[model samples]
Every structure is written in C-alpha cells, then in structure tokens.
Target: MEQLLLNVVTLVTFDGAVNWTVGFLTTVAIFAILALALNIQWSVGILNFGVAAFFMVGAYVSAVLTLPAPEGLESYVAGWGLPIPVGWLFAMVAGAVLAILLGIPTLRLRDDFLAIATIGVAAILRSIANSVEGLVNRSRGLNGVDGFLEDQVQGGDYRWVELAIALVVLLAVYWLVSRATASPWGRTLRAIRDNEDTAKASGKNTVKFRMGAFMLGAMLMGLAGAIYAHRSGTISPLTFSDLLGTFFVWTMLIVGGSGNHRGALLGAVVVGFFWFGTPLIQESLPDWLGSRVFQVRQLLIGLLIVVFLLWRPQGLLAERDRVSRFVTRGPDDRTRGGDQGSVWERLRSAVSR
Candidate 1:
C-alpha cells in the first residue's frame, strides 16, 4: 500500500504530468464558479434549471466581443479593441442582462415547467449560435481571441502562470461568494428558495430578490466563461453544448452539497479529477480493456449519480438546517376563518387562536 501510494505521488510530481495536473486544476476552478452560480439559482432561489443558457450566453458573448476582426469584416464589426479584462467585464454584464430577460418570463412558473422552459432556451441559443454566421461565424466558432497568457510568456513554463492566475481568480471568487452567502441579500435568496410566498409575506420582494440572484449567478458564470475562452485561446459554439457541460456542473453542485459554496468548490475538484483523470489511466491499460474503458467511465459516472440520489440526495456537504418555512395544510385543516387571512396572517392567527 505504501509503495503504491508513493508511485501515485511520484507520477503526480513528474514534470511531464504537471501540465495535465494544471489543466485539471484549471477545469476545477472554472467549474467551481459554475457550480456556485447554479447553487445560487437551485440551492438559494430554488430554481432548478436555466444555468445552461446563462453559461452559453456568457461564452458566446465573450467570444464574439473579444474575437479579432476577421479578414473582410474590419470595416463592419471591428473587434472591440478592449483589453481582456474589459472584455471579461462585458461578458459578465451581457450575461446579467440576458438573465433578466430570460428570468422574467419563466420565474413565475413552477419547478418542472421552469426547467423545461430553460432547457428550451438553451437549445434555442445554441441553434442561433450555429446559424448566425455574421455574429458567431456559424459554428466555425470565434477564433484568435486574445488569450489570457498570449504573447506574454515562452513555451512550457507559461502554464504555471496560467495556473497561478486561475488560483487567484478562484480565491477571489471564493471570498466573494462566502461573503455574499452571509449577507442580507443572500439570506433573502435562501428564504425564497425555501418558500417564495413565505418570503414575500415577510416583506421581501420576491421578484426583485429572484432577479438579483439570477443576475448575480449569471455574472459568475460569465466570469467562468471568460476564463474558459482565454484558457483555450479559442472559443467555439460547440463548447457550450447542453449535455456534458451543463450536466457536469449540476453534478458537481449536487455532489458537493448544493447550498454550501465550499461544497461546490470541493465537488468541482473531486468530480473534475474523475472526469478527466480516468481517461489518462485508461490510455495506459492493456489492449483488451483500454479501448472500451472510456465508455465504461461514463457509465460509472451515471451510476454514481443514481446511487447518490438514492442514498444521499442532499449530497456530501448537505445543508445542515432546513431553511424553508412554508407549510402545506390539507383542506380538512383549513378553517373558514383562516381562509380570510394572508399566509402570514393565518400563521399569526393560528399561533394566537
């Protein structure tokens, strides 16, 4: 056992392996941001879906705005000519704006209906990205965008710099999310998640709160998109496909503990390792099993999700407290006098009666 552990550690420490490790860490940091965004919606606002649309919008907007002018288009949509940081800001703002537009129509719907609506929105966005030639280059994707590390460093060693920057961004986001989840605004979001009507009765403006959470979550997703675009040094519409990207983010959030930011981050790191690392190991296996193991890895992931739902739906770092206070009473228990009162008023009267 000791020798096996030593071999694993040695492999991780090797110079050739460092780049892959850094790439994995970068993926974890990016998805950690995405998980946190979904947590704001699903865990804090009780909105289960729509993260995919926000994520796609962020990626597309950032890629388009920052992409260098194509050969003939210099006269038309000449690139914004802004620095990468400015481009990132634009990406985040665009995401927030789109979120408001998307949220207004669907926020009033119940859980499953909202999910379906949001999924439709994501599909529509992808289709538009694929079809809009002038805008996104029609599935060819946006290329030649200024990379975060472009022209700034030599080969081989530059990944370290990228890794360092990613770490800084991750830490900054971690601090911001930690503070936000403890703020009054965050508490209101949690209240809405637990029971929207109850939150409104307590004088919280539910619509306003929901919009705020949606926008904030969208902004974080946009930041993640910006990092992703720059990290790859290229952006493609296909990168935002609804399957693995969206499901992986959801899986990370679920595995980490939905309402907890720390859990979200940890879940991203844990799942990301398995998501990418297993394939590397499979590549080295004997010929008989190595070829088919990639398929098996995906099957294992699906099975894991099913098992988790069955045994620990709350997830690894489940929220310690029940944050919602809405009560459901049967018709037999609803007295005529209580029917005349608002939800809050009825609760008060029930206590006093």
Candidate 2:
C-alpha cells in the first residue's frame, strides 16, 4: 500500500526524457484534434453533447479495419486485416458518416434539445457496441492491432513512430483548421452561430453549412481515434467514454476558450497535462491520503469547471474575433462590420459607444 503511493519518477535520463517527451506531445496532438472537433461544433453554436460517439466510432472502426480476426479466444469480431493507413482513412469517413446520419434529423433541434439528442445518440452507440458482438467484439475489445507498424518501423518500440506521426498530423490539421476558420466559410459558420435566422435570410444555406461543419469535425475526431488506436495498439468501446473522452474534451475546449483554434490547442495541452499528471500527483500525496487522492483531483477538476462557468466563462484566452484589427486602419476608420476598437481600446470606447 505504501509503495503504491510513491511519487512518479521524472524523466531525468535522456532516454526516459525522450520517451516522456514523445508521449506528452502525442497526448497534446490527440486532444488537439478532439478539442478542435468540439470547437467546430461549439463555435457554430451547435451543442454537441455526444462527442464520445464520434471518437468511439473512429477508434473502433480503425481497430476493426486493421486488426486480424481473432482465434478461439475471441469471438464475433470484425477484422478486415487492412493496412493501418486504410483504417485511418475509413475511420474518419465512418465518423463523418455517423455524424451525417445523426445530424440529419437532430440538427433541426435547437440548443439543449440538440445536446440531449446527441448524448442519446452516444448512449445508443455504446449500447450497440456492448450488445453487438460482430460490431466490436463486445466487451473483450479488438486486440493484436499493430501489424502495420511491425512491418514498417520494425524497431525497439512503436512509441517513437507514433509520436512522429502524431506531431506531423497535428501540424497538418492545425494549419487546415486555422485556414478554414479564417476563410469566408468560417465567417459564415460564425454568422450562423451568432444568428442562424440572419444567416439564412442572407441566403446562406445554414443547414448545409451546419451539416458540413458537423461532418468535418467528426472526421477530425475519427482521425484522432485512428491515431490513438495505432499508438495504443488496441481499442474498446470503453475508450470513448462520457466522463473521460466526451466531457473531458468538452471541458478542455471550454477552459481553453472556444471559437479560437489556438485556444483549443492550448486547452488540449493544459487538460492533457492535468489528466496525465493526476496519477503522479496522487502517488505523491501523503501515505494516508494517496488512495483517495484521485477523488481529490476529480473534485478539483469539477470545481474548476464550476468556477469557469460562473466567472471566467470566456476562459484564459477570450475568443479573438473581438479584435480583427488591421494595423493600418485607424480607430476613426470604424470598419463597417462591427467592433473596431482593437480589443484593448474597447474599454475606452465603450463609454462613448
């Protein structure tokens, strides 16, 4: 019992440092994908409470696609034994398809109702994963899913391979999402988010835009799951859980500041740190409290959520749309769109405006 409470050793040595660094970066990458997915929905004023479903679909789909069929020990598992890359592609498609199917009817619902409907969809998927043996091998989960890496890297461990892939993927996705949010398309989504009726009135196909954004975000979630499965070498329905996957990702996005890509990425990093750090923190706690230290951490996390909701709702970084200032444009220019006080000067101008 006392030994269980030992502090987590830091990655002091070079080898250990490399491993930890890779693992940390991989964590950041995966959560960045998930948080960005959530941000896509939230920034568009779409309340997606079932983020776990898309994540679960992606992981399971990739695992099923890539894994070899189980022998006597396992039963009713769907294993195509395809290449991992194929699995990743299909996983993303699967997530997008799932989102489309779910979003078709559910998107019509507004706000809380849509949120509830989405969560219900997540619950439905979980139930199916548990009940349908052919779907995901039921509770046993699909295993032996690393044939691609074994063939490609053929090395000491696949962690480095995964880290490299994750970093590259993170950078690529970050650039794409950033470009997307800065484009006219992103502006349209924001317009719909702020006022769907106005956007529709202005001839924007609000429904199509919402559906497209939903699909795109789900694809990212799916991609995250695929990479995660490749990294972890296995996946189960339990992997995309409400508490850990869905709610946790949501918390990160909210805490990081939604509607901003940087905020979403930063949120992912911070939340990921706290998440992985919790076990170490618990182990480091005094002997008497170490066992229950996890509960304390949970308490702290909940308290943070509550405090942020009540007070700092905008989070550590406020959404940057408030200040789309051109360096050349003077304050007197007053761009026709709206709010041209360079954010900092907003307070000064507020009294007069």
Candidate 3:
C-alpha cells in the first residue's frame, strides 16, 4: 500500500508538470503572435492602442462561422458550421476590413490623438457586440468552440497538440512578415516611419503604406484571436479584459526587442511564463491577501515593464540599425595576402610578427 501510494503521487506530479509546460508554450505561442502583429504597426510608427477590437472581432467571427449552432442559439445570429480554415480565413478578412475602416478616418491623426481614436474605435465595436442580440449572441459569449484538429487534440486532454498547432501558426506568420519587412515596399515604409515629410517629398505614399501596415498587423492579431477562441473552447468579454490585454502585449513587444520579429517571440516566451505563473504562486499566499492577488500580479508585471523602460529601453535584444552583407565576399574581396581565411587571420599573422 505504501509503494502504491508513492507511485500514484509521482504520476500526479508528472502529469501536473506536463500540463504546466503545455500551458506555458500555448501562452507563449498566442502572445508571440499578438506581439508580432503589434510590432508591424508599432515599428512603422503607428500607435494602435485598440488592438483588442481586432482580437474580439476575430474571435467572434471564427466562433460564429465554425461552431455548430448551440441548441438555444437557433434564434440567435447563428453559426454556419463551416470548416475551421474557412472561419480563420474570414476572421483575417474581417480584421483587415476593420483596420481599413478605422485607418481611413483616424490614421491621419498622429501620436496621442491616434491612440485615443483607436481606443474609441475599440469601445464602439465592443459596445455593438454587446448591445446587438443578432451579433455575438448579444455578449452571452460563445461556447463549445471547436479546435482546428479536434480529433488529433483529443478534446484538449493532450495539450501538446494544441501547442504544436499554435507554434506552427506562429512560425508561418514570422516567415511571411519577415519577407514583407525585407522587401522594397518595406524599406519605403521604414523611410516614412523615420520621417513622414521626407518620405512624402521623395514620392512615397505615406498614408497608403501606414494603412497597409495597420491592416497587416490587424490580420495577424485576428489570427491570434481565432487561435485563442478555438484553443480555449470559448471566448467572451472577460478574455479581452479592457486595458489588461493591450498592456501585456505591448509590454511583451517592448521588453523583447520592439523592431524584430524574433524579439517579439522572445518577449512573449519570457514575459508570458511570468504572467501565467503569478496566479499559481498566489494560491500559496495568506487568505487575507488572496482577494488582491490579481492586483498584486498586475503590480509586479507593471513594475517590470517600468524597470525595463528606464534601464534597458532597448530590451534584451536590440534591433539592428542596418542590414549587413558579409557573404558576398569573393577571392578578390580577400585581403592582399591572397585568400587568407579572413581579415582576422591576416591580423593575427601581423600581430605574431
């Protein structure tokens, strides 16, 4: 009986560890996607504080299109029971459309006004979802949302499958965004970001590029929303959490290295683990302080963000100012010493002399 009890305890502990790891990876994957989406706009000098609007839109779009109609939801706006891919595609489209609509009127505003306008846009969108019974089921929130590969995921009991799905999507987005940012249009976008007047005077369409970046970012964010909705098997206003959602994603982007996609992923992994871990740690605290656990967690995360901003504003990994081309060197490109392994080899030989 003693041995059996010990074995049971060991099995439980191992299972808990696996669950924890799976949750961490899933959080990192979803947040990494959000960070990358925000970076596309932020890196190009757009301040999109209303990203949650896109997130909410995506979640609802995917849920409504893919989920089978709930028994009582027959009189509601209703779901089409489409394939998961179709829902995701529509989600991306919806996000891009929303971005374009918002950008047309508000992108002209710069800095603080732009942020405020975007925030208002988000508020308006959320309000519509809540007030309109035909839409988003009147904020009752969708349930029984299905995953992309439900059978393979085993109803989420096997968390590894969900993590794999999230990671694969994250990598694909990274590759596409990287290519976009390295293109000629991307260079033009950067020029406009650096100096709008200069880029405009030089014949670049500043407004158009800015709008494009905003739309692109919104699409990625929408994709993230779809993933979260399906992965969690439900979504509601509670998930968005007003400023809380925006705060962590922006923090991740800034803390990980704002300008690079890799930085976004890094920030997501590093900060996401801590963010998710705090709630678990709260359970060990005294009952008196348990009520304020959420506040304490936010305080800790906020403090870390402030510290990073004050001391290491560039983040753990800084963005490169210029692209280098080192592999283009030929035999003639070598030092006069005739095909030395590298410049370092000649330098070493001279030093030995």
| Overall local distance difference test of candidate 1 | 0.70
Q: Where does candidate 3 clash, by residue pair?
A: none
Q: Residue 204 of candidate 2: its Cα lDDT?
A: 98
For residue 131, give model 3's deviation from the true position in Å: 2.3
List candidate 1 stretches off by more than 4 Å.
Answer: 1-13, 72-78, 284-289, 322-353
Which should have the higher lDDT, number 1 or number 2?
2
Deviation from native of the Cα of residue 331 in model 3, angstroms: 25
Model 2: lDDT of residue 324: 51
Best by TM-score: 2
- By descending lDDT, how would the candidates be arranged? 3, 2, 1
Q: By summed lDDT, which 10 consecutive residues of candidate 2 come out lowest?
A: 1-10
Q: Kindly list the per-residue Cα lDDT of model 1 for residues 177-271, writing each as its tens digit.
A: 77887788888888887787899899987878777877888888888888777767656667776655677788788776678776688778878
Q: Rank the candidates by TM-score, best first.
A: 2, 3, 1
Candidate 3 RMSD to the real structure? 8.2
Alpha-carbon runs more than 4 Å astray in model 2: 1-14, 322-353
Q: For model 2, how does the per-residue alpha-carbon lDDT over 1-353 read when each residue is reduced to its tens digit?
A: 01211235655466765666667777778878889888987878888888888888888888887777767767655676888889999989999999888888878776687788878888888888888766677877776667345666756576667777888888888888888878889899999998889999999998899888888899998988888777777666776678777888888887777787776887788777786666656656788788887677667777767877787676655564443536444344443224343543542343244
